[model samples]
Target chain A: MKMRVHSSCSAAFSARCSRQVAPRAASAQAPPAVQVDDFDFQKYVMATAEKVNVALDAAVPMAYPETVHESIRYSLLAGGKRVRPMLCLASCDMLGGEESVAMPSACAMEMIHTMSLIHDDMPCMDNDSLRRGQPTNHVKYGDDIALLAGDALLAYSFEHIARETKATPEQIVRVIAEVGRAVGSIGLVGGQVVDIKSEGKKVPLETLEWIHVHKTAVLLEASVVTGAIVAGASDDDVERVRQYGRNIGLCFQVVDDILDVTQSSETLGKTAGKDLDSEKSTYPALLGLDESRKIAQRLNEEAKALLEPFDAEKRAPLVGLADYIYSRTN
Target chain B: MKMRVHSSCSAAFSARCSRQVAPRAASAQAPPAVQVDDFDFQKYVMATAEKVNVALDAAVPMAYPETVHESIRYSLLAGGKRVRPMLCLASCDMLGGEESVAMPSACAMEMIHTMSLIHDDMPCMDNDSLRRGQPTNHVKYGDDIALLAGDALLAYSFEHIARETKATPEQIVRVIAEVGRAVGSIGLVGGQVVDIKSEGKKVPLETLEWIHVHKTAVLLEASVVTGAIVAGASDDDVERVRQYGRNIGLCFQVVDDILDVTQSSETLGKTAGKDLDSEKSTYPALLGLDESRKIAQRLNEEAKALLEPFDAEKRAPLVGLADYIYSRTN
Candidate 1:
């Protein structure tokens, strides 16, 4: 793929944050669309991530029973891509909503994501010692505190959205329900259970699809859909956003699986090749690396097509996000 | 105290389900009120518990990902007093709302309570093997699945209430917020953190009160208040229910401490005197047994008084519940 370094920002930063566009030969028959070369995807991701980080920090304070709050703050404040919250904000903005209105729900999405990471890294679960290049929650704080902190964060996610969201009661209720369903049995937890059971077994491709769709895609879908809901998007628009979210959600995981085998641990900030070591099935394992890369490209194209119905400028962040997911090396 | 066993039910059942009343001489200055001689407190408790158990059984099915669902059902369907759900139903009924309207929230309450118990009994936490006369969640399911099950249940609690509740959107939002707060860091998780930290140490009375108030009373308070909110009760009525719940909630824990010291393991359906064994501070430890009993009596009276404004028939279950909390030997 041909990559162009936009000169809108400083040359040094532009070199570090190049936006990669698919080669024109790959989409010869596609409609002429607004060029994404001018969009500063790096600046958009960083700015949204910084806003979410500040909001998260303010949401969970260093309160009494310092250990529990500290444990929560420790993992929550650890840096990440903030892809989910950025998607949320972008979707809301696309639907003509102000950033302030969707900020709580955005923060809530990150809180839930952070909580899953904390619990997933527990001694009884994945048992990882390092996450985001720091000691895992259970490794630093004892398992007991880490467990409570995860529970606290899960509970706080709903409370924060409900209490902090400035949307109408109807909108707030829908957001809560959406976020709740994404985190509940039929979503994250169910996927984790199936994944654990399928370990070391020859799992079918259908089952693998179900696992990733539920565990990862559901929350991403919620993030995008909730942003639209909070902004009072019409039913058609909501459905379009949901489709966009699902395609990219799957694309993100496919790329993640490829990176697990192809990238180094330092670049990933986690244990690379851990999936192969554990014999956990991944897209790259089931399909060849080349095939997985092809699937990701297809998904990115489909996700970007779903955003075509929206105004070009409004959809830039989401469209660029799809490409970002596909082009990420880590 | 004087005891009265209502003969409204069969003699055999009456013998097994006696209702104890405070001696008339104990409250000489109190106004003459509805006679407790006719109210079937045992029948009310049994009937509510049975109904709640059946509802709970129907709420969580043994579906795919059988381990997770079964784990939730195992602890949820296990026979217990179902005091929390009953409090919710009675509170809603008192405000003239149908049981159907409150059933989902009641089930959600049980789910949250069961989740707390499951996580609390994990190996990294309290690490108990027995709960409700059977092996605890971690003992039957592995620690990893148990942890996920707890998370699933907690997530489902909010979802169930939001999706199944028939109340107004405003009321549903309030209930979700209320339940979330009760389960978050400032409530159950917070109390557990402090209790764990203070283990084997001489905690002050104030610290103990804070622990019990946050740990036990908050959920009970949510139970009553949410019920009132769902029924669209006046703000005054909700406040009254909150106060009544708080008083009885403290009474329940105080009596529990007394029973831990006095009852056998078989009678309590779990390990007896475990708190004393762990050197954890309790009401009976901080205050003498006699003094704790006195305090419990005072709390029961205060709780009952809070219910006096409601119609006698409407408040029967709550008043009976307060007395039941006091008189249970187990």
Candidate 2:
């Protein structure tokens, strides 16, 4: 792919977004035959994740409700991989939108993602005590503060978008509606209910897909779709972006299931094969590891194919992200 | 108070808003000495409550994952007085806006109110067994579903407003910001943390007010503020409306405190004296009952006085609603 990526993470991003000089330098080691610009996918991901983290830290400050804010800050800053936010920023970047315009929404994606994790780890839900290499929100802050922290984060996500996003009111409202549905009963919550209901029971592939599609894929779709919308992409383009997002989202879940069975707890940072212990149906469990890997490969290939119609250089981050999701061990 | 009220709730409201002819008739049997219009406070509340209930029922349908939706419907449709919604409607009505313009926000207020109750009643929080004359959401639905149900309702409230409200997108975004802040850590959840911390201790009067103001009054303020904003009211007028809302909100809490001490569980529909049993500070506990009642009266008067500058006929419902709050026994 034709690309503008370079060694410096912030420099490559700022070259596209900022009026200042593009301090970005193309790789000096490029072969004379091809003169290819090697896109530093890891650096791009790191750069975007840093921006999301900074915005999030400033977004929710410790105030009078110290415990809840402390609780919110704890899980929020708990050092997740920030994959959802990276996807959001990458989509916006691909569509030639400024990082400043999409940063609030990019941070909001992480906030919702964090809230799902916090609530999912509660005693009433999965009851997992560890997440992202640290004690869970409920495990560290106690259930009451943990619940309120999740709720505060959820409520604040819309508020942060509405209050901070430098978009037209129409676009902001659209983003809110898009985001609300992604987390509402029909989206993450719906998938959760089904997953909870189906635990320890015989499950079909379709049902398992439904669980992951809603629980995992829907928010990822929303993250990308919203970024595309904020970038003023046309409806047709947004739909294509949605399909791309959906493929990667499902691919991410398939990879997760594979990792659960194949990777040890030392690498995954949580109990390996816990889903098997709980009898939760997963891609690898339902369709052997090899088949699940094949499905993931198909998903990633389809995801990148959808991006071909866009500018190849500008779409490098998303293409790289899909590859990262497919190849990562954890 | 010179007023435009009549026997029928729909008639009285329609007279002010719809182009349809006002079938509203002034009281034929007005006292000859004063020639006063008797605003039927009961019918206005009942009528507005009916409208809010219909909107709420239409807002959340039982789609997939029936359990969460059922839990949401249970607490949402459970017969509270619909006080928050009525206050929202009353604010819009007083500002001369159509009920249709504000009805979605009106229902949204109740959605938020219901969410707070659901979260507050979980065993990790207040652990209440009964609410609005029925079992609490967590008591009826399992804790997991109950938590998700509350999360769903809270998420849907914003979606409903953004999707359904007919106002300008700016107005809707502003309303979302307002409502979101009202429920965030520094709003309802903030007050809740303080309340929880203060339990089984001698909380000061100031601390008690702080708790109720955040936990209770913040949402009330948002409810009225959102309604007025959707009605196209100016900032100064909205602030005036805000003052009126704050007074009524504080008054409602004080009366709740008094009833907790004076009323029985059977009469008040829930465990009335449970606040005392938990050693939670209340208006009557911090101040003598006589003083607390006097404060409610003062608050009610101040609340009504703020509405005096508006068209007397237009403000009748709000005036009557404040009076109803003051004189209410349960």
Compare the candidates by TM-score and give the number of the best one. 1
Q: Write the per-residue lDDT of candidate 2 for residues B179-200, one digit (tens) a residue.
A: 9999899898898888888888
TM-score of chain A of each: 0.92, 0.89
Q: What residue pairs are clashing in model 2? A: none
Docking level of model 1: medium
In the range A286-327, model 2's lDDT, one tens digit per residue, is 999989988887887678777776765677788766666766
User: What DockQ, between 0 and 1, does each candidate earn?
Assistant: 0.77, 0.70
The whole-model lDDT of each prediction reads 0.83, 0.81
Question: What TM-score does model 2 achieve against the real structure?
Answer: 0.90
Top candidate, metric lDDT: 1
